[model samples]
Target: MSAKKNDDRKSVVVVGGGAAGVNIARPLSFKLDATKYALVLINPRPFRVLLPATLRMVVSDADNLGTTALVPYDKIFHAENGTFLQDSVRSIQEKSLTLGSGQEVPYDILILASGLSWTDPIAFPDSAEDTKAYLVRNHEKFAQAGSYLLAGGGAVGCELAGELKDIWPEKEVTIMHKQRLLFNDTYTDRYRRSAANHLTARGVTLHLDDTVEGLPAEAGPATVLTKGGLKLSADLVLKTTGPTHPNTDFIPSFDADALTPAGFVKVKPTLQLLNHPNIFAAGDIIEWNEQKQAIKAGAHAKLVVQNVLGYISGNGSSLKTYKTGFEAILVTNGKRGGISYFGVLWGLIFGGWFTALLKSKSLLVPMFRKESGLV
Candidate 1:
């Protein structure tokens, strides 16, 4: 809401070209005075990834799903619109960024949305080509597998089981979790029951309260041992377990106290770093007390952009504060079925074709394409 002086341009650098960076940079590019502010987006990947669609890509036999999820950076940003640096951040100085390519980037304001890491074969690839290759490799493995075991009953695990079952109905698919609920300590009891019922209807075996002890070190199909003394064999076993690593190691000089024990950067309600006001954070890298969903990240990006403008223009009051809102989750079962839970006390659940129409049909790929300016 604040305007900067047009005499000298200010550099605003955004590290990580995911949802947070793109949402922040793209909107600010049109809102901010081009002559007085420059927006620079830095990410290792050549394209912005729509992470939600990854589960479908892994389970389906199609190759186009993964390709459609990766939107090119050139389509989103340009030299005139903003600077897009296709490189990783080696380290972060007070007001500068050191890229892996040995390039130094200075900025008056910085937004860190570098994201986090998940287990292999499920995590996003490094580049567009890598994404394609990853999808191809995993699709082949899935197609050839007789039995699939999904470790963890989170959204990813549930959706994966459903997709696998939908694609190969005769194939054996099981979801293993250490807890009773499908969502496992995240959602309410109602949501948990609903998810369990949906998966049950889809013929996805649920091994609740079961822990996977280990898998063989062999390269091919092998037996999996469970801590509960259960042994199961699967042609493919994918672990979507918790304990994700944050991508904040690049900021070695950052105040350790400003980071959570889990390593996520802690920020004020205004989305600025607590210790360093000039630095902001959003997306999976933030320590926000909310589900790390793309919708939430996009909302966070807007607040970060507003705060960054206020911080650089010397109008601190112009910065807006973020408030946690109604929690919601959309769990898609496949092309024709899914579930959506919104709110807490008065939460509403939607299933069947309604949920499929909302997500499963195309996994919102068209929405992402338009969001990244690909259209």
Candidate 2:
């Protein structure tokens, strides 16, 4: 089922409708000359899931945050400039994509924003209804559990611990991380310690420099052994160890060398694929030396859009290069407060009042909704 080419216009196809994919496609749809270029965004879901607020959604569904997180793609693009196909890519060819529906969509320029995969609560199902159900189930689990064990102290794990403690303060919540800090080494030691202290102040237990082992498959009552010779018991065990891998299995079929050993795409500073100048890679899939955050992915999208526009307008020499900006992170602990870090002037760390006003209070859901044309 090969899609007919749009007359003489060339297609600029974007894969995955996550943060990077949608950001790239949204700008391209409005900025591109509709007569000369056709924009296509391919994603498996009809709605985009706002991942940052999912931890709070799992613990509590206040203000219907779970439903608000999943924004529909119907208003993202106009028909004259762009087409949104809710389908997954089965394989990638040199000039076209073979979708799961057996349709082949050709492209003159390609952008791969296919993000990585993560465990549930952070990752949701395809449809909006199913995703709501999934959130409800998790919320119920959290409500019923007397003890919660989070098996990774990354952003997700720490934020989740905060959420659980905020909601059920008496319930035992513990985080077992392999690393010595709450977050990775990208942040300052003082900032990391502050995060740990905030959680500890809320009576959340921290098992730093330890790893959980021998956990059952299901999320029920279980006693788990740790690598640090400690036995822990919990009513529910959740693993938020970060991304499993980038969604780049289809890229190997097109150009094997375009991928790195870790399955991330190799790209030039201009955000173009190493082996294919006509293709671009961004977001978590790109092999960039930085923390994989929404801010970083949004920056990648902006750069890719600029570079792609330049390439298509025959001004490739003037294309902009993507430089990793300073490190800025906002880690929320429930709806009341959290921690924030800015890499300016050595480092600037903010506590609950500032964090709450900036993000934790509303989780930036309103901003995302307005951006998605839902407001």
Candidate 3:
């Protein structure tokens, strides 16, 4: 790690280890020549979260969420060229990052792929041991609760409510969302109607165009009040409607223009920062006007890697452009059934027990393991 040896290579530092960060860093670590490039990935968590499988873990019957989704960094990145550090960035400069430990890492190229933050089970635990405890605690809670209230009509809330009703049919389950329709604006009316019908058929109650104000003070058998004055009682209440903040607060006060009006990093079509060409971004952190799905994030990472390599090779003219296309989502209602919208051209809602077979059975654990080089 001598200064002279390090000076011979270009430092490529990537902040965050979420979907976009890991995907971008793994490829670069494997492809970049060690003598010419230094790849370093920084993340606060010990392990990256597999968000697609988290909802199931929240309501799963399993004692522990076996390593199906959570893949460690050591298994994913190449040792020769990749370096993973568990640290949080405190501040950022034009070409360097100051971590929480007060250590500054200078980089010739920076990639900001730290995705958005989320609540409890949806987000990964800070350590390996904590992840196991979280799964066990949620399993016990789900078993003990007699009634459940899910507040949100988004994919998470709907899917969770569906899972609850399917598992414990005798238990009372209610879902409240501000939107009249399920899912988000990206989905079509046909798909929306299908989800609503399926959930109702599964014996799950729906409260559309309603907002919950707050929960009762009593911990046991609390009554939940809505903004519209509707009241209901449930043993356990889960709020899936919290405000999500981007992890870009580390940016120095001088370079405030890098952030957009909504606080997301503004990136060009090539995924490079709007104001800084040496910096690139992808995933939920970037101000890309599209659904923040894994598919889109993966695509963004591919273009970002290509553009970053071109810039490092002194050939920026070959940068690729990113286009936001039709919205696609494979939403599972529960373990038994689900609905999906593949693309605009497809124009058909795919639902039923077979759709669940594609994901719910194992949450794509084998596929993720193969991608992470665990196999």
Candidate 4:
């Protein structure tokens, strides 16, 4: 703990401990020379959810899920070698980090792999009418949980409606798709037909090609009033919307303003920020024009770590570019299934049971354990 002892070791600070941060750190922690590199992790959550598997948890499948996903930091990164402080990061310098607790950490290299926060109706109250009355919890607020009005109608929304129908037959589930249906990628008519038929048959209402304009009181408690004067009752307004970076508001050193027009970090081909080669980023935070994937995020982290290692080895930090390729797992739960689009090969396993089991089965406990060095 002495200053002299600390000064003798090189340090690498990583912000965010979710998928990208954990995966990157786990591999590098094992590869780096113990005496040469030190990892300092800053995060707020005690548990990182295995997001793809959360559908099962929504239905209260906590027993098996307890072991499938969720890794405690102590188990994942252990033996008193690395450090984990349960604090959110505020901002980052080239080689330093300012945490919420006012502690400043310096690193030889830095990985800004923080993830994004999902936007719900309440999060942007000004956009909709009476959205406040809908969402209950600040974190898990869903207006449709006990009522009838649904928010989004994409993959998350669609799957959730199906699950609710399966579990609670009498309860009404409404899905508001912004487009016709799962328009992110094209699916064969058979896939849509099977899914639509199954959901409709189960009493789940599919409202496609509609956007929520506002929520009024009369349309209260599961019913939402849209811009087109259409009123629908919904119990829970869940959001399966994608993610964007969090914590960018605090970055001061670089032209943090260069973050994309939509508020994401702009990185070069090598995955380093548009500026500040001393720092790099990955995961949902990076503004890449493509679908977000864990494998790509991991690969970006690897490249960043490699460049960091090169700098340490006195080999000159010339980094290799990070390229994104397609990789997907086909998810089929209930009756219908769609192929997840990976670049070269697409894997298929469909249905709600399989869909939930595909990614959500692991509570991420073991993965965290392995990442944290518990194994």
Candidate 5:
């Protein structure tokens, strides 16, 4: 450690404690010389709410399930514990941050791990207060209503619908995919067929090649008006329509244009921000042509930490990287069990409970929690 930085409390602060952030912070804290390097993690939540398994949580009262787990800041970051700030980030000024409460925290290096945001009523505002309120209330209504019409048959939408079917077979669950279901032309047809066949076999109404023109204006529980004018109503409308990069409004005056056009911090193979060497980022929130999967996000976080340590040690060239062409997609289809869409055989298929055991069965939440220091 440089005597200068050691005296100055050279530290790393990771923003956003979810997915990539936690993964990065854990290892960095693990590697650091406690007396020389300080690690800090900041997020609004007191604990980590394992996402990806959110589907299982919403499907039923399985909050007690292993993957649907959450834990306080103290649980992880065990040794030389990083500072956990439960506040939103208002802006990032170089290696420093301006918290939502107006407090400023400076870091010798920064990791921006804030993940992606969901696209829906609570997130994207399609209308004013009344209209927005109308849309959001539908989520609450649908949760109790049991019957659901999920819009945008993407990963979140499809998984949620499938899990709901698994939990409440009696309820009608329909998915609206604007294109062919999982139009990931990346996978072979065999794998897609197995996964699709499984979901459809569960009475999941796959409404492909359709779009929701709009929702009925009246509040109390409404129907979705399709492009073809077919009216379909359900207990709720869970629109897993899309996801977008988290807000980086702090970028403009701060070398904003230095990032990818998609606003992700552009980094070298080392994952260091190309413009601000001390700043780095990883996760679905990033704008790499990188795949946006939880495992990949965690992998990216590990790379960032390794490179940051290299940067600290003046051995930046030795940082890690994500393996090229790494693709693994696992899904569960309620009654039909599950399937795998992955590499080598490309769209090679797997079957039954074994398929469900892949990532979706809690995204390795139990494993992460164990790794995070809780036995």
Candidate 6:
């Protein structure tokens, strides 16, 4: 962490260095006037984890996948105007933030991009080495397991099943989702069916509308009992039922009404907190009616950048409003197969070839590396 220089410049502090946080901080580092503002980004981790490629990393022995996924934050700032602090925020006040190290950082502008709290296989350990070791352990366990049971038929669950089948074709793989469709009802039935068919063609079993009752905590041979009284046997069990909640426990201390019942921050069209103009939020933490993808979080960052700069420019009236555009998602089955859906023109869905060429081939690892200044 860089020592804060004694200056009169106002501070612009950004919390959480994930996709949305980095996107907002990186641009502000260049665009924000250093003479008028001191930019700082606070995150617990030293590196950003490429979440989209994590499933492939755990299922395959591709060493480079893990290496490339965890990008360092050394080169995120273009100059000396910005500082990256590897610290977690303990609480947030009206005009300042208290970190876990007992240091209080005052800010004229604050952006919350804390994202969500995910389980293992999707979420990794803090340090790069620990995360790599964790992935290696899971990979070994996956190799040794004779069968796999994945709870929830969302993107993560489907992708993990595909990766497992791709690696061990003879291994029995089963997906149990409470919903009838693989994805949520936000997508067309035709698109969801197509995605399910792709997985089924690979001999992946689907147990739709059946909820798993008790999920095993450890990886071992066990029989999982579902709510529908189905006894499923598997050597390993993984849960991809999405994140537990938005990481906003500290927000209620500052403003109780700022968060929704689900704990996500309530933001205006400009992505600013409803009652606090100086505070803004993006990523999965924001109350946006769209798919919580990294791409959408990046879009939120861009808009927040424009609005934050505009707010400080003494022209707050002209802040741009964020409008949720068409819903689009690309679900990768494995390294060479997947599905793509664009909710436009009565919903257009693409098959494996297009998805493979677009996302499955490299999982956009190279693009993220370049964006993080690794390339």
Listed per model in order, the count of residue pairs whose N, CA or C atoms clash below 3 Å is: 0, 0, 0, 49, 0, 0
Better of 3 and 5 by TM-score: 3
Q: Give one digit per residue, the lDDT tens place, for model 5 in 1-375.
A: 211343556778888877788888888777888777778888866666566555564444454542236555676675656677787778767557788778787788888887767544324222234433543454355457757787776667767767777667888988877876554556666766666677778888877778887743332355878886688888677667656566555655567665666766666666766677788878876666645777788788777877888889987567676564657777655434666766674355677667657665555667767656675
Error of 4 at 326 (Å): 1.6
**What do the candidate models score in CA lDDT, each in turn?**
0.80, 0.87, 0.78, 0.59, 0.68, 0.88
Using lDDT as the measure, which candidate wins?
6
Off by over 4 Å in 2: 1-3, 78-80
**Model 6, global lDDT:** 0.88
Show where candidate 6 strays beyond 4 Å: 1-5
lDDT of 3 by residue, 1-375 (tens): 222334767889899887788778988978899878888889987777777777777777442445666777886677657788888988887667888877778788999988888764465567889878777787788889999887787888877876787678888888888987987777787888788888888888899988878653322456778888888888887777533688888864537788977779988899988778899999988887798877788888888889988998888889999998778777777666888777667466788766688876666666666655676
The local lDDT score (0 to 100) that residue 98 gets in candidate 3 is 80
lDDT of 2 by residue, 282-364 (tens): 99999989999988999999999999989987887999999988999999987787999999998999999999999998888
Q: Supply candidate 3's per-residue lDDT for 137.
A: 81
lDDT tens digits, residues 222-303, model 6? 8889999999888888887878889899899899899999999999999999999999999999998899998899899999
Q: Which pairs clash in the backbone of model 2?
A: none
Give candidate 4's total backbone clashes: 49
What TM-score does structure 2 among the candidates reach? 0.97
lDDT of 2: 0.87
TM-score against truth, every candidate: 0.93, 0.97, 0.93, 0.78, 0.85, 0.96
Q: Cα RMSD (Å) between model 5 and the true structure?
A: 5.1
- Candidate 1, residues 1-375, lDDT tens digits: the string is 113323467788889888888888888777777777878888988987778787887766554776688787786654366878889988777666778888887788888999878665567667767777877878788888899888888888888887888889888888888887888555778878888999988788898988888754332376888988988888888776643698888775556576778888888888888888888899988887788888988899888877877777799888899998888988889878889988777678888778899988888889988878876
